[model samples]
Target: GLNTADLPAKVLANRALLCSELGLADQRIAAAHQVHGARLRCWELDEHPPRFGSGAERSRIEEADGHLTHAGGLGLLVLVADCFPVALSGGGQVAMLHCGWRGVAAGILERAAQEFDASPVAFVGPGIGRCCFEVGDEVRARFGDVPEAASGRMLDLRAVIEARLLAVGVRAFEHLDLCTSCRSDLFFSHRRDGGVTGRQAAVAWLD
Candidate 1:
C-alpha cells in the first residue's frame, strides 16, 4: 500500500487495493488526520464506524493522534514514518497512538492510559532510534526529566516512552528496537527521506 499518511486519490486506491489483497475489504478501519498533538478519540461500534478508505467516508473520520475502543470489528489505525506507533490493550479495550516527539511531549501516552479498563499491555513499534533521531537543545528540554530522553543530542524516543509507560503503571510492555531511519529497506523515515516519504501503519482491534 501507499503511505498511510496521504489520502489522495492514488493513496486511497492503493489502500483499497491493499485491503482487498489482505482480505480486509469488509473490515471497518478507522484512521485520523494526525496533527502531532495529544488528542485522543473514542469509538463505538455502531455510532463511530471507521471511515478511512472511501472518499466520502474519509471526510468524516476525526482529526486526532490517537484512538481507543472496546468495540470489536473496528480497527484503530495510526500512520508513522519516524514516529513510534504504540498499542495499548487490556480489559476489553484497545488504543493505538501516533507518538511523535510533540505528541509524546504533550502527554499522548498518559492520555491513552486513562481510557483502559485495567492496567494495559503496551507494545511500542519501530521508529527513529536514538542513533538517528538527533534533536536540538529546545526539543530535549521538553523531556528534561526523562533520563533516556537524550544522549548528547541523539534522542531516544523509545526510552522516553518506556519511562512514561512505567510511570503510568503499564508493566507488561514491549518495544520493537528497530530504527526506521537505520533500516531503509524495511521502513520509511521522514528525516532520512528529507520529509518526503511514505508511511507504515499500526492498527489494533478487539477480537
Candidate 2:
C-alpha cells in the first residue's frame, strides 16, 4: 500500500521499504506530483540526476503526469488509485505516465509516444474500467471520436488511451484490464471507497 495521499508518517517509510525491496535505491527513483494535465518531464542522466524517494535529496519533481528518462537503473514511479499507469519504452528511453481521464484527454500518452525515437511499446496497467466507470455526459463527450470510448456515459478510458497511442504511432500494447473499482480485494478504488483510498505504485526502469 504505497499511499500517495500524504497520510501519516508511515507512508514515506512504506515507500522507502518498497523501493529497497525492489532494488531501487532511494536516490535513484524519480517521481512527480501528478496534476491531471499533459505535462511531461524529460530527464537526462547528467543534467536531471535522480530526484525522488527516501534519501536526503529525494523529492518529487515538478507537477507532471508523465516522466521520461534515458537513464538505466533509475526508476520512474507513479501512484494510482483508479487512474491508469501507462509505461512506454523504446529507443533507449522509458516513460511512466499517470494517465487519469483528464490527462488522457489532454493528450499525455500521445506526448509520451512522440518523445521516443522509435515506436514505443505500451503497457496499460489496471484502472477503473468502463464496467464501473459510469460518468456524466460531459465526461463521455470528451472522447466522442473514439468508437469504443463511451457507451451511454460509461467511459472506457482504456479504449481512449489505446486509440490515442495508436494515433501517435505506438504499435505494440499490453493491457491489464483489471478494474480497480470492482477488484476490491486487489486494488484501492477512489470511487468505490468514496474518494478516500490508498494508492498502488507503478514503477518502470531499464536494466
Candidate 3:
C-alpha cells in the first residue's frame, strides 16, 4: 500500500522512484486503490491481459484490501492514514492487510490468520492509535463491549491489536510504534489534520 502523498503528482512516478531507490524495480511492484474491507486479491509478475473493474488501465493483477502471493517478485501493497496496515510472511509467502476499525471488528486479522492455517510473522504498521482515536459510544459498541466513549477516552489500540493477533496464534510480530495523531510530524494524520489529509502506504515483499 504505497501512497501518493508529498512524493509527486503521479502516483506511479513516486512508486517507480521508490522501487528504484529500494532496488525493487526488478521485482513486481504492485499497488491498489484500497477500500477498507476484508477482501483479498492476489497478483503475480505476469501479463494481466485485461481491462480493470472500472475499465481503466489493464493492470498486471487484481485488487482488494488484502493480498497474498507466493510469486517471488510481486510486491504487496496497502495504503493507510489512520488505519492499521499489516504485513505478514512465512513459508515463502507474504500478505499485506489494510485494517481499520470496521475491518478489525469484521475480523480482518482473523482472516489473515486463517490464511496461514498454522502461524505467520505479522507486522502492524503506524496509524491512528487509541490515544488519538476518540470516538463516540457507537464506535466502541461495534467492537462488542469496548466501553463507552466515556468522553475523552483513549485506549492502547496497539496493545489491543497485539492481543488480537496473539489470540489467533500469531506469536511472532513487529510493530512500528507510531501514531498518526500523536506523531503528526512523521506520518499523515486524518483525525488531527481534520479529514483533508494525505495517506501513507505500507508495502512488503520477499527479497
Q: Write the per-residue lDDT of candidate 1 for residues 25-105, one digit (tens) a residue.
A: 434777888999999989876755555676666556677999999788677888999999999999999999999999999
Local distance difference test, per candidate? 0.85, 0.84, 0.69
Candidate with top lDDT is 1
lDDT of 3 by residue, 6-46 (tens): 53345546555666665655235555556666777766556
Candidates in order, TM-scores: namely: 0.91, 0.92, 0.81
Q: Which of 1 and 3 is the better model by lDDT?
A: 1
Q: What TM-score does candidate 1 get on C-alpha atoms?
A: 0.91
Q: lDDT: which is higher, 1 or 2? A: 1
lDDT tens readout by residue for model 2, 1-207: 333455545777877787888897777777776889999888787654443554444353567888899998888888898999999999999999999989998889888888888999999999999999999877878888796778886888989899899898888999999999999999989899987888888999999
Q: What 10-residue stretch in candidate 2 is worst by lDDT? A: 51-60
Ranking by TM-score: 2, 1, 3
Task: Pick out the ten consecutive residues of candidate 1 with the lowest summed lDDT.
Answer: 18-27
Residue 207's lDDT within candidate 3 is 71
